[model samples]
Target: MKLKTTYLGKVYSFSNLKELFAKANEEKSGDRLAGIAAETVQERIAAKEVLSTLTLEDIRNNPIIPPEEDEVSRMIENSINERIYSSIKNWSIAELREYILSDNTKSEDLKRISRGLTSEMIAAVAKIMSNIDLVYAANKIEVITTCNITIGQKGTLSSRLQPNHPTDDVEGILMSIKEGLSYGVGDAVIGINPVDDSVENVKRLLHATHDFIREWKIPTQNCVLAHVTTQMKAIRQGAPADLIFQSIAGTEKANRSFGITAELLFEANELVRKEGTGTGPHRLYFETGQGSELSAEAHYNVDQMTLEARNYGFARCYDPFIVNTVVGFIGPEYLYNNKQIIRAGLEDHFMGKMHLLPMGVDICYTNHAKADQNDIEDLSVLLTAAGVNFVIAAPMGDDCMLNYQTLSYHDVATLRQTLQKQTAPEFNRWLLEMDIITEDGILTNKAGDLTIFNR
Candidate 1:
């Protein structure tokens, strides 16, 4: 077989050290030809060693991403609340201990034993206390939309106030857009509050959202736009939505807002198609508001509903209020609730259109699976089999899986290197089966590592 060899001793075959060394050792050495082969292996091996060292340094120096202010505050507050709750549950015992320790006549030995607070333990507690302060101080809570208020007289004797009209709070509107772009998503989900029982308020929100998209540089194609209840009615009554967002809020109204939005989208698609003057049918979108109190049942229902919509060929956007990674084990009831929903969504049949974007972490994949191992492994493999394309990002999750466009030779090499370092057998197996790698393990393409490969 003809192979490209470089002065860098790039071996064109084999997956890693184990395979490469095995192949080389199987052949005899010492002749000129053997020397060339050995040199090739040695150079590649040297490259591997260099790469491994760099990876170690990279891992060590990898900065812990500063959690978003609101996210961190919520996490800390929730943690502290859980601690307080637990303490309250044992208040009787704690009160008894306090009483015992407060005795003035207690011996020095008894006092020492009862009131012992180790420097290390005190330091740990101090760290946690400090974090709580830092989190709250750094976090800011801001409303996402503007409103119009009517000041009413508290008493008949009081002076009458003029009826106030709904107006846009441009700053607040911009904040949500900015925050969404900065922390939520590159492709954001915009929600306009249209439930104030005022048509003007609905229109203002609509126009504001539309203007936000243009001013904030939020790409039209990348956004999933939604409007609340009154806005839907306004649109139904012949309000212009060309510059406004597609409907979403009305879906939760007493009259079935989702159905209304869906109907309008379909009608809008037909109108444009018939006119042949407007953009085509695919421009329409559906945004669904999902609320769950970090419970397994609630999560399952969210996922189930998303999956159901997907099955019906509808692409639904979900905004989950509570998720597991955020709350962790502290809120077991809520934790189980939200996780169940996520699990069901992932396992859904038509999960492609079911957007499972949690604000907490980004999920990205580098390659398609050439083979499957376990349930999760098979699901990942199936995504590849179904031709799901991954958008490249730095890294996500506890295990930093490099997100790539698709399973390719270069991706294989990168994934292989990562798996090798992490000693993750599942990752290695998936890479092998994806055909992103050669049977022997060499990258099928001329690419090297992720940093270079992405560049």
Candidate 2:
């Protein structure tokens, strides 16, 4: 194989870009010179004859040749292609929201005629909506598509829906395996608490998610956060920053995991940007499940940490879904006194401290513990009056569904439908009228051109 390398700021076979430019200059000017320079640059580079030392200063001072528009287009297209492919290889289904919806025309142009579109349309819409650049393209009417939304079983998180968490059984695991094998699941993860020393169990779950993604060709979120955060805290708490960095750098997997998580989160932020076509139904939420509730101090720390998370973006720290029975009080005496309990649980960190993620009464409906139906209804009404987004309703014993009256699935579906009809930059003002989301929902369009308006 011939040795290949770049020299000075350019690549060279015989040693210089100057000679190549000289030969090209003998015959062309204007677009033709541009065309030759554009075409010749690659050959020169490939032949190892590029002048690597060339810098912006070189261009500003010597101005050998202005880069051709075609060259620029080619480079931009290459970069985009690389990004799209890399994203597909590394990201999970949850992560795909921004990428799939990026090319709007791929999604929106079909919406007008799409009676019952296929999974491809759904995936395309999701990808277009999530990718900011693609969405920007759509706003320019160069692309047309809305964000995609499909709800399949989401691994352990979904299993939390079934009674006894039965999804953990061999049969359930096998079913998950089969679905993953068949494409019924997107990214099916099987996470067990590391505290449980269930390494084998964790591996099985990871493989299940991985296999499902491979078989179904759906993207997957790395469920490593729950495990890694806990482990990282233990390992890196007191280690010097340099040491931590070195340790992380020493392994590609270690370094990449953090990067992957950060990228996914950043993508999520971009997808839910304030200027998007439609607003998300749930503005804020608190994730307090296992490690979330430890000591009361631990709970407080989690609350503080979540507030910190919110500072990074739009999440807030708040109580888990609230329920009346959990308070263990009754009647007006119980009701009057328990208000303080619920209030303390929800408002402990809200005054200039951290944003709280309460269940907006419209969103959650729950009956945790109440002897009478009226008692439950009273609490539900109180939650609604308080303007909480998620509420705990125990309509089904033992299996309480996270209910939402204000932000229904139907409402989300409608908002999505509206957004599908509208492209980026185009205002879909009618979304405000839908009342499923907020009036400000479509306000983002004011900033651009392709935006659709109610009129």
Candidate 3:
């Protein structure tokens, strides 16, 4: 019936808090002991600390994490896009879409309104706007849909290496490679989703991944997929902000939960661009999903897919290099099941293409859903045919920290070659150099050893 208490690296054990306090009382340290216990209980109460059990051995095995630092720095806060977000945040979704439809709506109003909308409203605006006007807005914003930072031409599909880990563990990263799959060494950018926002850990992943790139000489870039605000701070602090990453939604409030406003997103994108983080107008990489609006409680009674489309409208305002819809990754609550997941993926891709955005689709399903790899493959085949701009290449279509199965490494390679598709421009060149793929796009024996970090 003994329990262990760990505070600031030291461990104390007792049958109950009273016994621990008695020991502290003997040393006149009861105040400190009581404070630590209260704080621990308060922090973990929602996760249910009452039934929790920890042995001294367990405490020894698990290291205590430090307190989370301020997520966004002062410099980052000062750098958010100067465009006033209040203009749109105050408006309802219906009012915003109506404003988009009215010719009298000022360009600034539309710009501001774009930030506050969700997918249904985004799709609503797109559906009502004339093709010419959509084109006009794209040009007005200087949006760039197609980019060749690494190696392929326009219409060339790319794949992102999504090797995520809880602590940015180096071995976990290399495991993806040892599976005869070069994660960060692949065709597109190597973007790792750092599980926490710790600045040092973020930098460690960035530096290590860059080292891997150097060791392999892979024609790809690296990104620690943190929030835009966090990435901005990392960039300012000298982390490799190779790609500015964000998960945008139609509403300003929803975006804010991820530590960003629309203007903030714009500023983050602009900051990375000015810092030379990415080239060829492909600085920003975004991930979107259906049901985000509802998840945010900002759906405002609109359908999830439509709101998802609206997010593209909002996202396109930044003119991102890559916009990916993480279909079904949100789970069964919003998308419901396999059919809804598949439908939403195609809808998001089509919506992005319609918005003149470079679209990528993550045809994924989670363990909590009534779906499987067959659903992902089905969506993958459809997205490929839909000419998706990029797709995620994780192991078994699943990421450990992400806790969801996405497209696998083999799926990406086989799909690209079988579809006779090309990779990002410079990446295609690297594949050619490695002789992993032939001039006509056939996989060679060299492709098998792509798993090697260094040739």
What do the candidate models score in CA lDDT, each in turn?
A: 0.26, 0.25, 0.59
Q: Rank the candidates by lDDT, best first.
A: 3, 1, 2
- Residues 190-263 of candidate 3 have per-residue lDDT tens digits of 78888777777777777787777667666666788876677787788877666788887755556666667766
Compose the digit string of candidate 2's lDDT tens values, residues 109-162.
Answer: 332222221112222222222123322322221111111111111111111111
The best-first sequence of candidates by TM-score reads 3, 1, 2
| Per-prediction TM-score to the true structure, in the order listed | 0.29, 0.25, 0.67
Q: Count of backbone clashes for each model?
A: 17, 67, 19
Per-residue lDDT over 4-86 for candidate 1, one digit per residue giving the tens place of the 0 to 100 score: 23335453443332222222221111111223223454654443333222221121122111124222112212222233234
Q: Which parts of model 1 have CA positions greater than 4 angstroms off? A: 1-168, 182-189, 193-197, 215-218, 221-265, 271-281, 288-311, 314-338, 348-350, 353-455
Q: Model 3: what TM-score?
A: 0.67
Better structure of 2 and 3 per TM-score: 3
Better of 1 and 3 by TM-score: 3
